[model samples]
Target: MAADKPTAEAVAEQLARLREDYQARLPAELAALTALAAGFGGAESDRARLDELHHRLHKLAGSGGTFGFTALSARTRTLEQQSKQWLAGSLDEVEAQAWQSLAAEVAALGETLNKVSPPQAPAILSARDSLTSDETVQIWLVEDDASLAEQLRRQLESFGYTVRHFMQIGDAEAAAHTQRPDMLIMDILFPQQGENATEVLALRPILRALGCPLLFMSSCDDFESRARVARLGAAGYFLKPLDVPRLVNRMTQILDQLRAPPQRVLIVDDDVALAAHYRLVLLAAGMEAEALHEPQAIIETVAAFRPELVLMDLHMPNYSGPELAGVIRQHERWASLPIVYLSAETDLDQQIEAMGRGADDFLTKPISDAQLVAAVRARVDRARQLDAQITRDSLTGLLKHASIKEALEITVTQARRHGKPVTVAMLDIDHFKSVNDTYGHAAGDVVISSVAMLLRQCLRMSDIIGRYGGEEFVAVLPECAGGDAQMLMEDIRRRFAAIAFSYSGQAFSCTLSAGLASTAQYPEFSGAELLVVADEALYAAKRGGRNQIRTASPHPLQEADRP
Candidate 1:
């Protein structure tokens, strides 16, 4: 018992020392946080300072709880949550009460630490480490803020990116024009206040002529700025004082999304075995395909398969390849679908005649498996590319005007049949041309892309969103209401506003104006009718301060455009 008493005292003494050590260290960290908070206000609020505060609070949240300062830990945890909200929200959205409460908690926790005589410290467990590393991907960072630029360059490179830092949009544009990078990470605000980066990029045409996905960061958090970024088609947006790891994670996601899906082909040949062999050849090369052995089933198979290129045989019991090609072209939908002849025929005149009969190209008999796979892959890939040109908007992957209209019709038809509600939203970026005129078309594209990405990200997967031509978008929310859709759009509005657009050395943001209408309100209204209602409501939003949403009257405003 005497030996046990000494051991107990020693353990208690060690615990007391730990508690005292943590309490001593805790004040300095809290002081730093308070100092950071004091600097985080007005237009000059440093995003970097806010992030530093966040990082410190996160450390304290874990460390305080571990060091047996339960009161300090609990208060710090509450403050951490409030800090995160302020970090994510715009300056206007930051709640004063929350901020004051956090300050009070910090003061209270400090007093708690001075008075409490706590129990002995147990074993301390460390936090799990951050992601080990990632494959190096090529990226470009364009910013004029020397300090922030250098900070970002080092951090992004440390995350396994081969990063090139540039100070101006012009320089980055020139470099990109010469040779496109894998991705672009840029500041929306630049040194040139008059420059619109997207407009300049649009005119240049060389950079992003194919597709170079982008991310944007800025100090400004406003609706107009985010709207501009959305129009420009940025895949990701960050409010500055960047969370380096989170930004890296977003970059990773953008790259992954850009990765191509497996190539698909639809093979139509009468010989079952031969078609199967060709299918195997293509499949081995990572192509997705379906084979049809019956000429009579060509239409049904083609419709179901939806292949990029059709593999047609010249000689079949039911129909010649040219005849089948003619039949395929007769259908309006399949007119542009590529039809390639794979046959035994060798006559040049006959091949020319087949080509004249709507077949795109001919491949003669005794072709090697390598040749077949390569040929099909090339043709299919090219065809899909061409199809995108026709069906999708060049910058934003959303459907073109006509395509979206057709999609709306289809969605409406389905909704009507099932007695389901459908909500239509017409959204336009506020003060968009000023963004293009001031920042250039390049910046405008970023704004458009940003909005498109947000629409895709925030909406339900079942919802269909489309680029409705020039700074405007249309979305079909099946089984959603005007109020529900309004709430969703407001969410997008707030999120968009929170994204800062850093261009040159300045930070900017954009906002959205949305008008919504739903079928549940007027069961008699068709899809087109709903659109007219939504359009009217949209105009109302434009009138009632362009950053807001307006729900249209349930009654029909005008006739909907029919397909």
Candidate 2:
């Protein structure tokens, strides 16, 4: 046969598809291989089975090498040789066991190889062509017309615009609770089909609450409809049958105008002279700074300015540094607020105590300007890590339920404050209890730990993964909408299902189901409400079937949204 020729794009797509397919089949393949090897007999019947396995290994080695899966090829080649030896009667019982062990090892390597294959750069490049780093524009299409909604979806997808669509304002409000898209394209004359007008009007407060860039789209651009959209805080108005190209350009311009550099930092100290001194140091370091003398007003000042970092003195009479730290920690909203003690508490014990009491770091009074700046930078970085760990699960290193809730709250607050997008997902292992019962708790541990590790490897570091007790895990993805979060979780679900766990000479496989909900569809709900909705979706996943992800009902009542 002539040497097969495939374009790089074709090969890459084929490889990507193969990786996806192989991940789906990997668990079963490994189980079969493990059982065959472990149960191998010393007669001709066993030889026939061994020959079949050898042929499979040979085929995998050859094809894997051709497909640039070098590690898979190498491991398969080793297995192929071992199988040959076992079949040739040149292998003793020890050699047979070794061959079986090698087969299992090769199977594991094959799973890894599937993930390591480089994703198709061309596909990413093509996707990127539709989006620009400079653009921050997004659109929401609220239409009962499914055709129009889908048409707009395709058009926006082609333009690389983030788009969300809903038939009812209730659904839209629910999505906006977590995600605040850049714009809203609404149908003015919604055919009030058994939906309450008050409920519909309630969506306006939710949209306004999100503070997102908004636009209205309606077939009937009547004065009443325009007036309603205006009251909803819309920025632009457009009639249905929108000019896609013109809309894109206009959105790009609006987003460009909104982009700006980072904000300034201000440190308030009761010592007036010291405050001014710190301000000058911060200014020299190229940051905007202000000094305030009143310790009591730090909270109000910070709330207004929203500075990224704060430094406080420990020795203040009325508001001690530790007390101030406690206040900041209690703010539930800014619990992760970085507070560094800048007092002259030189005692080693005091420094440790301050840190233990929520102070990110402590510096002796009369600190150097250089030391101040460096300490601020270092503590800010550490605060981020600690924030992550506090929310993450200890056993699986995923997010804990509390952390997931915190993240969702932050996302909702941010969207209501700055119009950013957010997504929440709940994951649960399928029939997990059965695994524990059949394989023993130790094997169950392996499965849970393995799944957690795989989830960490699969998701971006920016994404938050948390254990929600039992076999359930939750992920909070900032800057992502429901569709994208669902896809990512599904990929994780599939990869997790394909992984095999071996213990006590037996091998088993596992699967997961996930529920995805985003703020894009429901903009008015709180973070707590969004989590309930996501959890409800998880229940749907469990009900529909295991090993799948389900999107929650867009208009689920608040009380009914929870499990």
Candidate 3:
């Protein structure tokens, strides 16, 4: 059976249920703690029993405020601190009195638990819904020049963007009120609407209303104009005559960031209710989150989930968070995985000690849901950026050669096991060296990045793309037949030919050749072998003519029928 999709309403419902379960079990938990405290005969006697009592109080302290039992958590935190001090053999007069009062304090927990209402689950935006918007990207183009607007609109539409061209700022503003755009592309200068009326003044209200990202294009390259655009929070400012490819590249980047994959987080806390709460909060914020109660399963879970960050409790039964973090770091693969301790422990010395062990940071428990989401998001974003710098091509942000090969191997293996077809395409720019010789290396870079952007735009989200090397790329398309892949590559090739590049006031164009191999024909071939076959076919294409696709299959496969 398919699992129900995670949603804010669903998470809130689960949170309510969890709160009820926690509340039902609270009295019995307090009773058990009271009995444990009663049996305690000073810190030195029955150390195991003393430790058990401390652990129970520690859990209550950590979870109470999370479920809206703030007073209970606060009081229990004090008791837990005293118990820890006792365990350390710091039996001063104050410590002794604190230990003696444990039983009475634990008994008072039941009363405190009933006095406060649990906080309602926060309103969280569904991450999947936001990331996977069904509508095509809508762009508003406010360019008065008819030729420029038509050219720009056509270019954007070829990349699958819906471009709405308005000759005047007033028209774009009126259209914006009718239907909001995902992005706004406008000229810095406009015809005067009134005294001192500029495009900036006209756009101020619209920008504030839509809050969509803005890109400005203009003939004016002066400081004041640039400063005004910056003040309006323009994402990019392009100088005229605009390089359409560069503008498209900027738009691709903005869209890529908007549609980046959800950040994965692993929540490790022995307290089930608290863990669930954290998971729901993060899920609502559009991050992939899972809660693991068994500290023993940390390594296995970490490996399986491949979480960007680990949020763990410092104290757990049998296994501490720091200890688990150490076990995780033992594996060279996970050495740099961010581990954060989220505990109720406020002692600076203990937080420092925990961080020194293996954790990257420490987050005190009782953190609000908003703060938790913000902190986790910030850390995950930075971690992903750093990871990308290592694993992705700096020029195109596609997977590096080794990374793409690894991806291809993994995908091929999975596809073959399921008796499915996977196609690999080796793509290379035609006469790329000549481009470098005529244009500067910087222009060559722009051409390469332009192709990279087109690949991302033209291919399916499931397809894996990589920079095999300079001016060379690889695309792994799972379940795609050779014919279908050929058609797709042909479309990309045609689009690439249409894109115009300018260098030193001179305009030129370039094309690419692609070779494809499908698993249906080459079932025995490994990923590397399949890649080699595709490369041979690519060479064949280049030999035949500069711009075309050639397949490695002995007999060409027909395109699979589509609905």
Candidate 4:
């Protein structure tokens, strides 16, 4: 209880500040609403002003209850409904007495703003730790082979992983009681059988207690051995004569899948205070939230922020939520983007009408912080899943060709704007057709996916890799120089060549060649131009040798044929 006092006090102070801020701005907002109401004529030409007035009242109704002004919120909501009705009605239908009554109610809005106690703190305001990306990945390696264990420890450490080597399962279990690693790798067999030499069944409890992904490695490639590991829910299985790079690649993939990027949400509302409140709530719940006050900037902001879900206010001065949603849907790329209306509108018919205009759903105003976070998270998660299915390659799970090219162009433009260098690599598996001809298409897929995993494991997480088409792939490395990128590709090419592929009891290996083109070398080239140059260099690499890397020559002067 004592430990929670500081957090509670902090939340109280923040709520107090918000209440004060809302109170200070209330007089001006109320005055503006009153002026709009007084000047309303209910004529065709006065439609814009009526819309503005309605929007202001809508905001007041929504935010007033949020700050504990329940009475004020209710009054404004009735006025908002009246204004909406006027907008829907013709000049003949709107009577003079009705206009006067609405104006009077609007003018008396200030009287409803009498001081009230601030609302109680929301659950979202409780203190929570932030996740940092720089934390080292902890890996526990439990193997009876001391030499292999030390070698693996060294290799993982070189890749910036913290490795703990335990020669016995009992030793590893003892360490797990004190601290758990992010992932665990262990062997299935122990020659020195004893109480410490726990069998597969005995290891289940330790694995459950650690609560992390497990990767099993063994020399035996028998179906029984693999099936036994499968039942334990191991993240991966690696055969002996282990390729360390491939092992690290599997580890990277598992960690990446476990720690997904935070969900992105865009909050669009005319009420600055209310938008800020929602942003704070989402942020506390470990989401990335941004607010857009100017409705006209919706398209531009959405493009830059690339939010998974949009939380939009139902009414605004210039554009209603439905109109803006229509604008977003006009672009084919954003057609499926989620647009949820958050407003004080309680009419079922009106809500359904708004949804028909392009919104996916509607949430009533005065929503609690917890409800807002949960709703946003759920929507964003589903949006991400749908997006991945649409844009990613079916086999490699990387961006498809068209999507990757679009991403590269955007990355290049951003890098150029920041005056940073960007590099693009064109990679192709050497003798890929021969492998398919000799082995089979299924074997070809295994080789392709292996290269994809290697690329994902070897490249910096910030780099983007995609399967271009067939045996070819593309990688975009932001802020990487040509020489550095070439060196990286060379390392990957060698490691890939060392990987053995088995087909029908025959062991075969494949190699890859890569071409590099950097902004440092061709400063004036666009992403498309860079790709053309990289393709040229890729052919050059093949000409030089089947398994090597080549950098593009400088752009030709006055390239009349360049696309």
Candidate 5:
């Protein structure tokens, strides 16, 4: 028989089962330990008994967190340490300390264990799922009123959402069992006037555990009602009657958050095995990860990987982790990149010292797999979200208007310093207003999104592209003249014109006109000046004929200097 390996999901399921078994069996174990402690004698005869009790505490300390009961595990570790001192002939310490302290600690741990909920399998996001950005968002609505449900469904559908309505919580729960929506919109009021659905949901916590972003609307908008929704971790709560447009806008924002690309992580550890292990763990969890075993390659790897977070190992042969973090921070571009130290150093003072040198956080090694994933994911997600707010366009995935301009200015300054050419293209979709007038604004949006997708597909990784407001795109191409940029724009124009868009069963196509200005044509022009020149050429292209590329002429001085 071939050797079989368990899938990650299977491993997580097994771990969950093991964790549940551990939680269920904990109270009995704690009671037994207390029973043994109560009858303890400080004599040789009690050695084995004390050892056994100490052993049990040790096992709980090590295994509790591994099985997901980190609090219980930590408490057990403290008890185990106290017990160890007694078992190793320092029995007076335990006897000196009020026996009540140990008893109280054990009781407190038991209480925590008793309150532990059922173990849930760790959520795993696959590589394909993470890479498939902009997955169509699905929304499930739980509203008993059919008219309101239908109205919201139509409104959401118009915004390209797949909306499902559930008249009863049971139906929604059943649908969730089959297919979980990306988000949920629910009403706290049902047919029963006084029965708030939020209260009912609190009783049945399954919906909350499914982990979709939640939004709730309620006629009762009191503090108590808001507090109840807050406990459920709702993304938004609206007062009824709900504002459809505002709700749709909130839903879109949530969807954008969900559809953002997986965070990229760079692991810098001298131990190749450990780094590779971390990489696999992150990649299997639907993150982009690269590992660097050599400290010398840190800067290069970070530059190429463009990581949202860096996992640094404290001790390395070539340099210290904190020193490396400080080095990375010296580079202005990477100043804010999240750098977390991952090492076996457990001394709080030392960890704090490392963090003082520019590290964001310090996580001791031997952390549980789940804890590691959660830690890194939380950091990377926050870092990326913060970055997106500054660097990304809200409507399209292209660079934000100001960000692209900043990027272009930087590129232009570099080109000037190096005496290299760079091209800036200004593009506008031909007759875009007519598309909105003819079909609808929704159709116009589709056309704009389609063109954005095409540009992303065709642009070089080094090239910079941005959405300069509605139906206008600007792209920066390094080391290319206006002629070359125009050629590239012509190809984009052709490809975009070929994309067939449909609204209400009526198919149509759209095209774009472009203008290109190059540093070669006007060597002294700044990035902003180049943009103005490009925009002028774009208008000329539009006036000459729609759906064409126009290149700006070289400066008269530059033409004479060219010889």
Candidate 6:
């Protein structure tokens, strides 16, 4: 009979059970398989024993495959095939070595099977459920009736509306206050256990203060009730047992009406009235606009507001807009912050000077609303795309190495300034060279990839891991003390040592050693100094034992303390 199929976790548990259940049989099984593969060349009786061994492996394969122990099943199948060739007298010495290797592989695969936990199910099941596009709308639903609420929730989810449901009006209000949800849907006849409708009417003041569009749902069919709701600033009213299709269509229409292009404009003019007029024009177009009278605050304000584009007047009190553009360009952070001049001085030489000073494009003082909107949107979109590429790692889907390093350095500096602790760890795989030598380079690549995944799994999301070089990784742990760092390193060491790699019908295992250094006691030390200390401790670990962790001494080692 086939063994029952097991989940990944169950498979691991079964391996552990097997280790204990067949403890005495394991060594004998290994010995038999090894002897069968090695082939007792001159003995006829031993050849018969090999045939029996081949049958034993075949049974193991059939049972293991049914039980979801795939690695074991696969290894056994390969061994079974090789054993048949041996019985037919067609297998060579090199092929014999390959079969003998499978015994060791099965042992290692069993060890790995014993270590792994099951993979997690995805948090979200559908692409539409995940917020991938800016065009997708989010709606907040506040309803108390369980059945009706569930009906609406399912319909909205199916329609790709990111919906958040709340049972209590108070809870809904709290959420909206904190997150500023795009739209709100509330029930007017909110159930009252003991309190009267008058007390519920008091909630209208609080709701009005939210400033977002509100839609009310009720069963009341009177004109007086509809007028009252309109007074409460509700955009629309809907009846109970809602026409869900019509409601959804209306909601989509409402969102589309509200979906004006993001309006964020910077006005850099000394003339307050003219800047205010431009601000009025931009605001009328549904844009957020800021007017800056002081040319000196250009860089600071730009950094803070991140205005989509700047509109500057060429002639200013203290500095010309063209000169201010030149100053803003000098700041590396704001170098790409788009600037456009709104100058009355439209002389060809003046426009040339403005463009030369890094103004992306020039517009005369009498700029139309359409031209202004198009120019700003184009520049802002380009800037966002560039920022996304700059921050991402092309290879591993983690932060780019350079960006993470810069962030770590800033964190280290902040920790130093704030009198907090920081720890850095350097991890290296033990005897990685041997893996490449025994297996092909492709197998070596697998080992490296597996190690990278293991490191990512072991560390906290807050902790940063970067590929330091080939076969080495670095992690920066903010606010971690020396003792905590040691504990974390040990956990990583144990987890990494547990991973096994399978290739070419052979299974291999590897371990990692780490060195940790903290800047708690050594407050004056730089990030580079912390790295040096960690690297030295790593070398010490290699010298003492390959799979262990060594922490840097609090104080420098004396001459006699050196190895």
Assess the local accuracy of residue 546 in candidate 2 as a C-alpha lDDT between 0 and 100. 69
Q: Candidates sorted by lDDT, descending order? A: 3, 4, 5, 1, 6, 2
lDDT of 6 at 132: 20
lDDT of 2 by residue, 1-563 (tens): 54356776687788889877865675456545544443443334345547767887788778767656676677678778877876777333433335434534543443434334444344533343333222324577777888988876765554445677888877888876434566676665567676432336555477556555666666675777677667666667777566543454455446534432122455757788888998878755544455657767777877765556777777776777788778767778777677777766556767777888897766777789998777765665565567657665655556677766787687678766768777788788899999999988877766676666555545554566778788877777777886687777777776666554555556567888887778787688887887788887888778777688887757658436344
- Write the number of the candidate with greater lDDT, choosing between 3 and 6: 3
lDDT of each: 0.72, 0.65, 0.79, 0.78, 0.75, 0.66
For candidate 4, list the clashing residue pairs, or say none: none
Compared with the true structure, what per-residue lDDT tens digits does model 1 show for residues 373-459? Answer: 888878877877787798988777788899888888888888888788888899999999998888888777877877776676566
Instruction: Answer with 2 or 3, whichever has the higher TM-score.
Output: 3
lDDT of 3 by residue, 1-563 (tens): 54567776698889889988998888778866765665443434346556877898999998887787887898789879877877787333323334545654665555455346433222221221132212357798988778988988877776667788988777876655435677989886665543111345554586546767889888878898788778777799999999888898899989888666667789998899999999989867767688999877888888766788999888888888888888999999999999988877656777778888888987877899999999999999899899999899999999999999999999999889878899999999999999999998989999999889888887766689999999999999987885788888988999888888899889999999998998988998899999998998888888887698888865544321100
- TM-score of each candidate structure, all chains considered together: 0.54, 0.38, 0.68, 0.58, 0.46, 0.40
TM-score between candidate 5 and the true structure: 0.46
Where model 5 places Cα greater than 4 Å from the true spot, the runs are 1-134, 192-195, 204-209, 271-291, 322-336, 342-382, 392-399, 404-563
Q: Provide the clashing-pair count of each candidate structure.
A: 65, 17, 1, 0, 0, 2
| Cα shift from native, residue 205, model 5 (Å) | 5.3
lDDT of 6 by residue, 1-563 (tens): 55566676697887878756654454456544543433332223235445766798888777667655675677678768876776787333323224434433433333323222343222322232233212234577878787788777765554445678888777766654324455778776665544212245455455455556777788887887788777676778898757544465456556644543354678988889888988877755545577989877877777765676787888887898788888888888778777877766446788887788898877765767787766666666676557757875433334566776676688799778777788988888899999889997777766665555555544543477776766777888877877889997887777556554556667677788887888875677787888888888888888877899888876665213325
Highest TM-score model number = 3
Q: What is the lDDT of residue 191 in candidate 1?
A: 52
What TM-score does model 6 achieve against the real structure? Answer: 0.40
lDDT of 6 at 502: 55
> What is every candidate's alpha-carbon RMSD to the true fold?
19.2, 30.9, 18.1, 18.1, 19.9, 32.2
Per-residue lDDT of model 5, residues 1-563, tens digit only: 53356676687788888877876687678766655554343334345556777898898788887886776788789888977876776553443123434544664465445335533322322221232212345688999889988877865554456688999887887655434666888998777545577887788877876678999998886999899899888899997666544565566567656545566788899899989999889866766677888787778877766788999988889899999998899899999999999878656776878878899988888878788899999998788778777888766678978988999999999889878899999889999999999999987877776666566546654588899879999999987775577777887877677555667767687889988889998899999999998898888788887888888776664324221
Better of 5 and 6 by lDDT: 5
